[model samples]
Target chain A: MSTGAVIEFTSISKRFGGVAAVKDLSFTVEPGRVTGFLGPNGAGKTTSLRILLGLVAASSGTATFGGVRYRDLPHPLKTVGAALEAASFHPGRTARDHLGVYAIAAGLPRTRVMEVLTLVGLAAHAAQRVGGYSLGMRQRLGLAYALLGDPGVLVLDEPINGLDPEGIRWIRGFLRDMAAEGRTVLVSSHLLSEVQQSVDDVVIIARGELVHLGPLSSLDTDAAPQTIVESPDREALAAALTAAGITFSIGRTGLLAATGDPALLGHLAFTAGVELSVLHRQKAGLEDSFLALVGGGHTL
Target chain B: MTMFLRSVSAEFAKIFTTRLWWILAIVLFGYIGLLAGGLAALFAGIQTGVISPDAVNTGGGPTDFGSLPPLIYSFASSVGYVFPVLLGALATTGEFRHQTLTPTFLATPRRGLVLGAKTVTLVLIGAGFGVVALAASVGIGGGVLSAFGVDALLQGAETWLLVARTLLAMGLWAAIGVGLGALVPNQVASIVIVLAFTQFVEPLLRLAASFLEVTAKIGNFLPGAASDALVGASVFTMASPAGTAPLDWWQGGLVLLGYALIATVIGYAVSWKRDVT
Candidate 1:
């Protein structure tokens, strides 16, 4: 297996007319892991990926693969395989012919076409024209195209957008396997839930700027732990919580205490002689933290 | 060199795998065949006294029997050039229409190299279209002329030279199509410009220009006129007044090349290197 290369974007900025699409965005994706380039819709995820692949010009800074610009890479296809959009195929050409064109252009052997088709589970449909492909199949074909050169790095944009549950599961495992083989995989998606299980590291952007970048577990750490408590007598429960100096707020279901341990809240209620009805700690889901960091509930 | 050749080979595969090229080829063949054959029959009949010249119009076609064969063959370039242009334009525009340029550029990052490969491939395919067109015009048109007992001039060296030049003209027309395609890049707009100009605009301009000596001098340099001049014969050119002569064949070829060069250069500067996403 070819070793993966580190991808870096340094102060990359792209402006379209008066609007800045990507503003001073900087991040690095290391090898031997899958990095989820996560953001809400129109967060410049696609624009940033395009710049990294040399499909778009950055107004400032550089996006390079292993310190070399994508355009200057001697064997670009073999070094960095990119699939920017799933629908970027000619409808009239068969899947085989579509891959065949790139294979010949990239100077790869014809046998690699079949190899990738089988790899992506599209071998049976290779002869069929792309016009007849479903959205899921097109996504698979796009992945097959990316794998055509067996490059060390893979860049995919919205790869799982239309995949079925099974395909999504398969791709998750496939991405892990690729990472296991030490290939740097950067997959972009607007939703954290879609890639939360698959990715090891997360690079979250919002409004054309980097909002968070760290390991997947680190996102949840930023979310403060809370416990939900309720009682048949809401007045006593609220008083007990306030008297104990525990910060609490009223929610539709109960009083939300700022503490994570349900035991502490239960003990406090017992001492205050408050008739408790509900008490449980709320697990801070990565999705919630992601939404909070991006500064909106609209993303949900 | 190897990279360029591989890119060229990939371009050829891109064209052949689709049905559009052959569909346009069939249309070109039939359109040119019917025109050349029909005109041959009418002109040959008038020449042989089988039909009255007054029946068709006020006057007759070229009374020079020696020029009839080349004139029929010239239809391959004169009328059939549109198909290659359309084919070339479609080939480039479709990349933008379908967003295939993303993958194409991914495979070959050098944008200029990709455009050059496309031009080279389209030129060759355009020459191939020229061959199919010539086959129709020569086969049917020559048969019609021979049936009227006129010398079809199939064996003459001059007739073959016209055929060779027609091939070159078709190839250049295809290059011009690529240039136009790169310049416009929008499929519908490029196609509209091609049809509107080839079918209506240039024809009207050429006709209006033919009446004035000063305008006629400039009109001779027009793409269609230059094409006819390069081919050495066109039914359209036969009607021009005596004083307005077509440019030398080589000069016409240079003028056609100049258009392709200008379009390609401007297009490369304006849009070809721009961001695709």
Candidate 2:
């Protein structure tokens, strides 16, 4: 797979009513890789995609696809295929006709409609109207629409929302393959852990602002292999770490301690003769990193 | 050009193929024909003679189309005006109702182009309905007229002109509907307003025009008044027993055109300014 089209957002900002939904955000999505936009609800993940697609007017910043404004693009469908949040189907139009109209509009052949339908596993219901579709089916149809143009870039918003486990697995592999083909893919989801397992890179937002932006590897930076220790001398271990200035968060299960090195923590414990009931380096999961980035939009 | 035409063809297919649109079309044609039949029955009882033979222009119609029968032209104008309005509203409001516009807008990205294609579709559909409606009205109403030994004026230049006039008036009405559809973008609201003006309000205004001296004059510029000019023998809004100036067919046509242009511009303005989602 080739790394394909490049998109850049320069100081993009958008507001609704009195609230700023996206604030002075700047990021780049390069070709040939999957970039995950991770945040909790209302973190402005969907807003950014809308702006990129020219669906929403940006208040202060510009989002460009391949250095061109979305409106200026000669063939928008062939350039960027987006399924942003809403599964906007003409409920009365059959699936084939729904895709067929877009194909005609995009100047693509009719056969491509069947191809996409088959690809998305909507072939059996191709004659069915969208109103009867399940949430998962609607999502597949949305993806079919996005792929109709064979676009160089794919922008999806919370694609896994109502998908079952198998469906989610299929999408993850499909996205990976598309990115492998060198197409630029941006997938946004409120579930960071799910994205972390599925994405190579990420842009984290919190309360309408950028909190973290980097590879999934970055989530592991503050990560440690963790074990729940219920030692009678738990107080002693906790005191030792505190005196050593090791910062630890006390979770419901146990005193969550962070260690610079697991070997050192073990050596220290062995020397101190602290009986080990449970001890291990804490593993940093994408879920924790995501929760830390966006402390829940409304409460924050 | 091919791309534009292709999109237009697809649009036509969508509008023509949908059950709602077809139902609306059947309603429009049947309702107008039914109203004409009712009028034919009422007028047959009252006089059994064609009241309009001399050409009169009230709103937007071509004077040269020769003098058309009063009921024939009136029914055409009244119904024609409504076709475009419903078409316009249906074209845009359907998108809003079905939420298909997102994928549409996404595929096009050029909002202006999509809007342009829809405008073209509106005109095409309007003109088509105009011609078809004239045939239906004339064929049905004219036959009823001939049975009363009043077939003398059915042939000649006046007859042809009336057909052309019906076409023009109906096309304009449809365009106005398109504008309302775009601006409202809601099916229920669009239908309510369109139905209200065409049915209840105009009839009430026509009934009151005879008694109210000033309202009689204002009623001429109303939709029904404008329609009466094209449909009736003389343009002074003969539909209602109100005092109105006889606008030449050209003048009446211009008034309808003006209303259509204003509505279309406003529709585009709203669509352009609103967020795409």
Candidate 3:
């Protein structure tokens, strides 16, 4: 497995008429990791991917693969495999025949078509026309097409949309394995929880702007975990918090919230002679962090 | 050159893999065969005197009702042109309808090259339709004429020229069909527009133009009129007033080619540059 290319989007913006689909979107997807492109349905995730693939011209800025434009790649398929949509196929052609067209276009051998078909577990249905394929099969066929060229980087958009639970689990493991092989894997979806276990990095965007981007591990590290404390004498605890210059806010749940070492908060509470009924460090999960970052009204 | 050939081969695979070509081919044979057989029977009736000479002879100049081989040969191309046009239109619009254009463009990002390959493929397929139409016309019409003891003149050089010109005309119509597809990627709309133009619009305009001096000169440049002239003979030409004459054979070919070129250029301008998604 080779170290995959870095996908860089530098200040890219796209506008469809008066609506700005994407604006000043900038991020870097490093090699050897699965990066989840998270955003809502109208968040321009598909448009950005389309722009990167050279299907749609950007209104401004550049999206490059390993520092080169997608259009200028000597062999685009060899460098990057993109499965932007599951329905990008003719219904009349069989699975093998559909792959054969791309295989020929990319100058690959006929055997590669069979190889990819087998890899995607579509070998049994190779002769089946795509029109008869279920949504899950179409998704698998799209993946097979992406793997045809044995590309270094893989881009899949909402790959798990129509999949059953088993299929989704299989895809998650498959994506992780691809990343383990040193290929850059970028998977886009509105649901972060679906890709939570598979991705190493998360790039969150909302309304066409980057809201947060970094490793999933480091995402919670940016802010200290809040130390939640509840006391029988709320007034005394509040007064002590103010006098010690340990500013805190009252949560909707009637608990005092303060960010610091949990032990330190305990020490302060003891020193202030405040009797506490409850005291614990509240660690924010990725889902909460994502919702907070994107704001209210949007679900996980 | 190798890339172009590969694109062409991929295109050929796309057409043959689907049942569209076979259905269209069958329709072409059936349509041309009906025209040839029906006309042959009419002329056979005239020769046998089952239809009176007064009833056959109309106001137009003397037409050899039973003896003319050129009219039978002309049906192979002039009346058969629409099938190739439908095939060409379907070839392009089918991609849009089925959403296959996305993958095709993804494989060959150069949109112009893909269109070029399709144009070349459709033209060849159109010429194939020409050959089938010619074979049906000659086989059925020639047999009927010979059975009626009329001189079908199937052995003459003029008859072969008609055959050659018919093939060229069908090829051009195929190109024109591709142009229409490019301009209008919507399958139903392209079919409706192509059918309406070839069947009702152009024929009526041509007939209406037959009365006006300037419109007639301009109408000679109409695609169907040019196609009619390219084949060198048609029922319309046989029935038209004597003063109205279409362009010469070479000129008609040029005029048809011009429509295709203009259509392709405009199509590229309007739709090719737009994003696939």
Each candidate structure's TM-score, on Cα atoms with residue i matched to residue i, is 0.95, 0.86, 0.89
Between which residue pairs do clashes occur in model 1?
none
DockQ of each: 0.86, 0.53, 0.55
Error of 1 at A271 (Å): 6.1
Comparing 2 and 3 on TM-score, the stronger one: 3
lDDT of 1: 0.92
Among the numbered candidates, top TM-score falls to: 1
Tell me the tens digit of each residue's lDDT in model 3 across B1-277. 7667878888887888888888888888888888887887677667676667678655654535534678877888878899999999888888888777777776777778888888898889899999899888888877777777777787888988988899889988998988888899889999999999988998888888877778888888989889889888887777666347789999999999998888887887777667767
lDDT of 2 by residue, A116-227 (tens): 9999999999999887899999999999988988888999998887888999999999999999888999999877756666788998887789999898888766646554
List iRMS (one decimal) for every candidate.
Answer: 0.5, 1.7, 1.2
Better of 2 and 3 by lDDT: 3
Q: Write the per-residue lDDT of candidate 1 for residues A210-282, one digit (tens) a residue.
A: 9999999998873588899999998998898889899988898998899988998899889989899999998
Question: What C-alpha RMSD does candidate 1 show over the true interface residues after superposing them?
Answer: 0.5
Best by DockQ: 1
Best-to-worst order by TM-score is 1, 3, 2
Distance from true position, residue B159, model 3, in Å? 2.2
Error of 3 at B133 (Å): 1.7
